[model samples]
Target: MEGRLVLALILGVCTAIPCHAYYSPSKPYVPPTEKVTQLHFFLHDTVSGKDPTAVLVARPNFTTAFNNTPIPFGSVFATDDPLTVGPNLTSGVIGNAQGLWASTGQDVLNLVVYWDFGFTQGKFNGSSFSMFSRNTITQTEREAAVVGGRGEFRMAKGFAKLKTYFADFSTADAIMECNVTLIHY
Candidate 1:
């Protein structure tokens, strides 16, 4: 009887201790290894030109104040904005920021964004990093998470900081500077 009780207690204690889900009992556990890299670029978003980079895709009809606010709640925009080496649009295009943004706040420019910065013309060609964030947009800066990626950025994870370089209210256009750093293979 004491032996039976002792065995039950040992089993209970073993189950209570946590074990990593990815770890296997048959194989030795080794930490994942990766390399780090940094990228600097600028994204140009234009709404007024004949060739617009970002456009309104969806808008909530239920919101009575939709037309009153610059960026009404529930409004969604899709973007294929060009990523340039410099803040100016005339600069060389390195890649494109393919993303979607939805205005989630009633007052402020708060947005939920899913963006993929795909590099095409540079050394990081064919590689991309994705970010999903609840961003509170400001005139100064904000940050978003680089969730995961593929190609040269396989298993990538990091953060991207965006600083507003220029904003033209009349045309509803903006130039944002992005600095991305990530750890990947």
Candidate 2:
């Protein structure tokens, strides 16, 4: 009888003890904050002439190309617009855009755009944000792209939608609208 009792007590104690050495209390789930930013600007065809690779600019001033400097000028991106210019961007620009041709058959343009919010006037004054766009320029509208942010947008994940305002095939000039939605802590 005593042996059986002892075994029962040991079993009870063992079960009472936690299986894991470290026990973390359950935390209440907290959702991340959602942020959305919309930018409407002209994507100027800054290339001098017709070429396969084109460097496009979007800034308050038409002269400034995309650069790393924190300024209010604009962002620069490259695309295969059939219009060409120098591969390098002009000095003293704010943001950059890089485009990689995915496939010749599909004519897919993979765009990675970096926008510097450091020199802005209000709300987003010192943030570095980047977005990836798989744009099939042949199509009028493209799917929402993924965006990962830095600086003030730490731990941010989002979707970005682009709408073409205008596309001039001859001059390779275009205007675009971007709407972005992000969820971050």
Candidate 3:
């Protein structure tokens, strides 16, 4: 009778401990590994005149930046007014962006970037990736934004480090180079 009681007590303690879940008897546990990718691209920004037809009077407004076309106030898409609306923009060819006025109490420029990597070769041949980032850009280098991408970059998250290549203030045009690194499953 004493041996039976002892055996029952031992079994109860073992079940309560959950030792097998932590240290499996069959195979050793291994930590998860992360896969990462890095890329570099150039962003050319051109600030055009405000849209006169736009109904909103907000301090910050939306604008478009064309890929490989660095003209100020010009877009890749067709539009009636090039001076105010720039050009009409298409998917994978434009960055529908907005910049808040410094007087509006925001230090950085909010940008929604749609990068067209379609012309390139290799793994990302025809994928269009987008990122929403804040730019506190200066004359020197800085980490301007945290970027999460779509399409080929699905489920991938990363940061963007950028430095100004050149800036032409008179024309409201600038060239910035960005290095992006992402980690995913």
Candidate 4:
């Protein structure tokens, strides 16, 4: 009985001994940086010459400093008009455009441009614009003149042009202050 009791005590002590396993906390992951080469804005008229006519009340607004520089993440660009019924009779045209340029960081970049037209009381009638890649712009220089000439119809025939190049993003501001000449011919 004495020997059995001693063996049981030894077994209990062995079982009570603690053993530890290895573990490690995870490290946060981060992405690399990219560079932007160029950004350009182009305006165009969608309606044909037979539609309503329009005139330009303001010239094109632009930023040339970053024209040939590298744009980092979180970069932004914005434009607005505070005139009342500048072109459309019922409401005014207000717009804001923003962009970011990156290289290897991420293959895709998000670009948003918004326009509101309706009444001063927060009512929106209608508006139009577009979003696209920069590399797809074939005729960069002629895009402005082509769109400017088409602006003859005011909002009735106005359109926004956007094109994203390799690592650059661009947007044209909303064209305002133009007479919509009705065609009866």
Go through the candidates in order and give each one's C-alpha lDDT.
0.85, 0.46, 0.44, 0.29
Question: Highest TM-score, which number?
Answer: 1
Clashes within 3 Å, all models in order: 0, 3, 4, 13
Top candidate, metric lDDT:
1
lDDT of 4 by residue, 125-183 (tens): 23212222232122331121111111222223233333322222332223323222121
Clashing pairs in 2: 51-82, 51-83, 51-84
How does model 4 fare in lDDT?
0.29
Model 4 worst lDDT window (10 residues): 141-150
* Candidate no. 4 TM-score: 0.19
Q: Tell me the spans in candidate 1 whose CA falls farther than 4 Å from its real position.
A: 1-32
Write candidate 2's Cα lDDT for 13-91 as tens digits. 9889677768678899886666555543223333445553345444345423322332222334445322112222331
Q: In candidate 1, what are the lDDT values of residues 1-185, reduced to their tens digit? A: 99999999999998885665776568766866789999899988887778998899999889755356556788898999999999887899998989898888776667798989899986889999998987776547888899999889989999988898998755658888999899997
A best-first ranking of the candidates according to their lDDT comes to 1, 2, 3, 4
Residue 94 miss distance in model 2 (angstroms): 10
Q: TM per model?
A: 0.79, 0.46, 0.45, 0.19
**Which model is ahead, 2 or 3, in terms of TM-score?**
2
Score residue 97 of candidate 1 by CA lDDT: 85
Q: Write the per-residue lDDT of candidate 3 for residues 111-152, one digit (tens) a residue.
A: 323332222344664443444544444345766443444556
Task: Write the number of the candidate with greater TM-score, choosing between 1 and 4.
Answer: 1
